[model samples]
Target chain A: MSVLVFAETTGGGIAETSLETVAFARGLDAEVDAVVVGELPHGAAGELAEHGVRTVHHATGDAFGAYSGAAWATAVQAAAGQSRVVLAPGTPRGLEVLAHLAARLDVAMAANVVSVVPDDELVVTRQVLGGSVLEEMQLPDTPALLAVAGHAVEAAPAPAPAVGTVRELTPEVAPADLVARVVSVEPVEAVDSSGLTTASVVVGAGRGAGGPDGFGAVSELAELLGGALGVSRVVTSLGWRPHHEQIGQTGSRISPDLYIPCGISGAIQHWAGCASSKTILAINTDPEAPMVTKATYAVIGDMHEIVPAINEELRRRRG
Target chain B: MTDVLVCIKRVPDVGGEVTLTADGQGVDARHVGFTVSEHENCAVELAVQVAAATGGRATVLTLGPAEAVEQLRSALAVGCDDAVLIEVCEPGSYGPADVAREIAAVVADRGDELVLLGNDAADTGDFQVGIRLAHLLGRPVVNGVRTVAVTDGVLVARGDGVDGVETYELPLPAVATVLEGGVEPRYPSLKGRMKAKKAPIDTRAPRSAPAGSGRVRLLLPPAQPSTVDVLGEGPQAAAAVVDLLERMGVAR
Candidate 1:
C-alpha cells in the first residue's frame, strides 16, 4: 500500500505541523509520497526527502500560488489516485482540502485523528465532543482521507538516504475554482519559539490569569527559566493571547520536560493538549482546581504573588 | 446591489455539561440536542443587516440531514430571504472542506457576489472553514470579523486577534466569517416564525468526493477526580492566608 501525504506550507516553506504529518506517515511504512502545492523553495523537496519520503509530487499553477480549497482538493484527489491513503495535517488548509476531496470522492473524512492503522480495515482514532471524547471509526472504503490534528505527534528526524524523486503534477481546475485570490500574505509578527519545540521548560497560563496584562507575569517567569509561554483557550478567546500561543484541545499541543502552570484550572480540554508533559507543576488559588489534582506537584497560592516570586527567585539564582 | 450568501451549521448545544466514555474517545451524544451554532446565527444576522443597509438580498445555505431544515426555517425567521439545504449522507461526519465545496457549488449556481460564514463552528471549533472556503472559492477572505460595513463599493471590517483588533477594507465578492458579539443575533418573532414555516426551501445533493481511509474511534474523556478546599470568610482572614502562603514559599 502507498500513502500520499499533503505537505502544507507557509510563506513557501513547509509548515511544522506538516513535518509532524510526515513523521506520522513514515511510521506507516508505506511507499510514502509527499504532495507539495505552490512555489516551493530550492531546498524544500530535499528537506522532505530527508523525512523518509521516497517521492515528492510538486503541483504548481498560477491558481496554486494562494490556498484554494477547490484547487488543492483537485490536486490532492488527483494525487490520491495512486495511493491507498491520503494524509494531511489537520491544519485549516489540510482539513478544508481533505473535506472537499472526501466529498468529491464520495467518502467519509475522519478529522483530528490521533492514530491510524492499516489491517483488514483502516481504523482511525479522532477526538470529538470538543476534546472531551474520542471516537474510533473504521473506513471500509479505499483511498480514505485523513487529517491528523496538529501536535498529535512529534516530528522525527529524517532517516538517512536523503534521496527522493520529484514528480511535477498540475491540476486542471475550473474558473470557479480560481475565484478566490490572495491579495496579500503577511507573516504574523511575534516571538518565534521554533526552538521551544525541544525546550525542557514550559510555563503556561489560563483565563484565571486575567488577560493580556496577566500574561506579563507568565512571560517574565518563562524568561527567567529560559522557557516558553503557553496559554489556555480562554486567553485566546479573550484576545489576550494569539491562537498560536494557546495550549488547549484546539490549540498547540506541547510536551515540554517540565511544565509550570499558573492560575490555570486545567479543564479537560486544556489537559488534552499538555497531558504529555514530563512533570507538571500547577499553582492556583483554588486548591480544588482540576489542575491542582492533575499536576505532579501542586501549590495552592495566589498566582499574582506566586508567579512574581518565582521569577524573582530565578533571577537571584542566575545572578 | 450586493448579493450575499450566508452559510450556517446546526450543532449540539454547547452549554450543557459533556460526559466522556471509557475509551477516552467520542462524547456521549444521547443527551446532546441540536441548535443552530451561535456564531453562525450571528453570521446570518450580520448578512441580513448588511443586506438591509445596502438594499440587497441574503440567502442562507446549509448542509445536513433532513432535520437541518428546521435551522433553515429558523434562519428565514431571522430575516433571511431564501434558504437552501444541501443534503449530506452523514451530517456531522463531513468536515469543513466538504461543506465549503458544497456551499461553493450552491453559491456559484446562485450567483452571489459575497459569501459569509461563522468564524468557526461552535461544535468543532475549527476556525478554518471561512479561510478554506475562501481558498476553495479563490476569493479574498477576512476572518474573525466582529464588525462589517459597506462604503462606496468597499467592505470595511474589523477582526480581533491576540495582538489587537485589525481593520480591513476589501472589494466586493469576498468571503468573511463573523465573530461572536459582532452584533446581537435577532430571535425569530412569532410572525416571522410562522412566515418561515410557509416559505419554500430548496433541497439538493451537493457534489461530494470519495471517502478518505481514516476512521474515527469514539471514546469519552477520563473521569475527573474530585477535590475540596475550605477557606474562611472575611477580609480580616487575608493576613493569615498571606502568612501561610509565605510559609509555603508562594509569597515573600
Candidate 2:
C-alpha cells in the first residue's frame, strides 16, 4: 500500500512532526507521497525529497481563505485517491481535518498512533487516554486514516535519494467548504524557534516549582542554558504560564536533543511529549518522582536552589 | 433567542494511575475513579455561563452507558436546563463516525442554537464531533477554542496558536470545541445537587448504526526500563549539574 502524508508547514516549509510522519511511513515499507496546501515555499519539494517523499501534491486555492477543516479535508481527499494509507501529525488541525475526512469517507481514523507494521494485515499501536495505555489494532478498513503520534518517531533521510515531482492538485472548493474561516489569527506570544517542536534544548518546569514566582529561577536557568522554557500542564492550569508553552499529551510534544525537566512529576501526559528527547535530566528534591526515575541524569535537590546554582556554575565555567 | 448545548464525556480521572485491562480493549478501571474529562468540564461550565447571560437555555449531552447520567446530573446542577444520554450498551465500542452521526441527528431535530464540546475527548482523544457535527448541520466550526464570547449575533472564539492566540468570528448557530484551560469548572452546590437529583434526564439511543470500520482494541505500550544515574544532590552538586549540561552541549 502506498502512503500519503498531509505535511503541515511552519514558516513556509514542512513541520518537524510531518517529516517524522513521512519517515514513519517509510519504515512501514511503502512509497511515500505528500499533500501540501497553500503556497509552496522555496525548496519545499527538495526538503521533502530527502525524507522519502516521491510526489509532492501542492494544492493552493482562494477557498482556503482561512483554516477551514472541510476545505483542507476536501483538498486532501482529492489527492488521496491513489494512496492506501494517509498519515497526519497528531496536531489539533491534523486531528480535526482527519476526522472530517473520515466522516466524509465513512471510515475510521486512528489518532496518536505510535507504530504501524504491514504484515498480512496492517498492525498499529496507538497512545490512548493520555499516553497511559497503548491500543494495538489491525487496520479494519482499506484507505485508512492514521495520525502519527507526535514525537514518537524520528525522521531520517531516504535510503536512496529520489528527486520528486510536485503534482498540483487543487480541488474546486465549494462555498460550503469555506464554512469555517478564521477572522483574525494572532499569537499570544512572539513566534520563535525555541518552540517545543523545534527547540534543541528545553528546560521544563512543573508544580514543584512552587507558585508562579518559582518559575523565575527556572526561566533564568533556561535562558542561561540557551534553551526554551517548557511547563507541565499543571503549571498552565495554575496560571504560571500560557497554554501555548505547555508540553504534554494535550500540549505540544517536544523532541529536543536535551530536555531539562525541573521539579516536574513525569505523569503519562507529560512524558508522552518529552520521551522522544535524546537525553533527559531531572532536577527535583523528590528522588522518587516519575521523571527522576526516567531521566538519564538525576539531581536530587530543591530546584529553587539547584537552578540558580547551576546558572552560577555556568557563569563560573564560562569565565 | 440563544440556546446552548455542551457535549461531555465520562472518563476515568486522568490524575490517577492507569492500568490496561487483560483483554487490552480498555483501561482497567477496577480501582480507579471517574470524573468529567478536564476539557469537557470547562465546556459545560462555559455553556452555562453563556446561557445565563444571554437569557437562553443550556443543555448538556453525552453518549455513554447508563451510568453516564452521573455526569449529566452534574451539568444540571450547574444550571443547565436539560440533560441527555445517548445510552450505549458498552461505551467506547463505537468510533468517531457513529458518535458524530448520532450527535448530528440530534442537532438536526432538537439540538440548541449553539453547540460546544471539549477540544478532544480525554479518553479516546478523538477530535471529530464538533467539526463533523458542524458539517452535517451546515454550520461553521472552530476547535481548540480557549476563549469564546458573543457580541452582535456573532461568536468570537480564540485558541492558542504557535505565535499567539488565534481568533475566529462566525455567525450564530455555530460549533466550537473548548480547550481545557479556558476556565475552571464550577463545583455543584448543595442546593443545586438537590435540584439535580430531581431533574429529569432525556435518554436516547444512537439513531444510526455503526457504519464505519474504525473499531479498535486497546493495548499497553512496552515499558522503557529506567535506571536513574545519580550524579549528586543539593547545591554542592551544582558542579556536577553543570558538567552534565556541558556534556549535553546545553552549557559551555
- Using DockQ as the measure, the top candidate is 2
lDDT, candidate 2, A12-123, per-residue tens = 7788888889988888788888998876789878989988898899888787646777789888898897688888988877887887787678666788888886676677
Q: What is the C-alpha local distance difference test score of candidate 2?
A: 0.81
Clashes of 2: 8
Stretches of candidate 1 off by over 4 Å are: A9-13, A158-162, A170-173, A187-202, A210-216, A226-259, A268-279, B3-5, B13-17, B20-49, B57-115, B124-217, B221-252
Weakest 10 consecutive residues of candidate 2 chain B by summed lDDT: B211-220
When only the first chain is scored, the TM-scores of the models are 0.84, 0.92
Task: Write model 2 residue lDDT over B63-86, tens digit each, in one string.
Answer: 988988998998899788899899
Cα deviation at A133, candidate 2, in Å, is 1.0
Candidate 2 is scored at a TM of: 0.94
Evaluate residue A203 in candidate 2 and report its C-alpha lDDT on the 0 to 100 scale.
95
Error of 2 at B126 (Å): 1.8
- The reply for model 2, stretches above 4 Å from the true place, is A119-121, A190-197, B208-216
Q: How does model 1 do on interface RMSD, in angstroms?
A: 7.2
At residue B31, give the lDDT of candidate 1.
Answer: 81
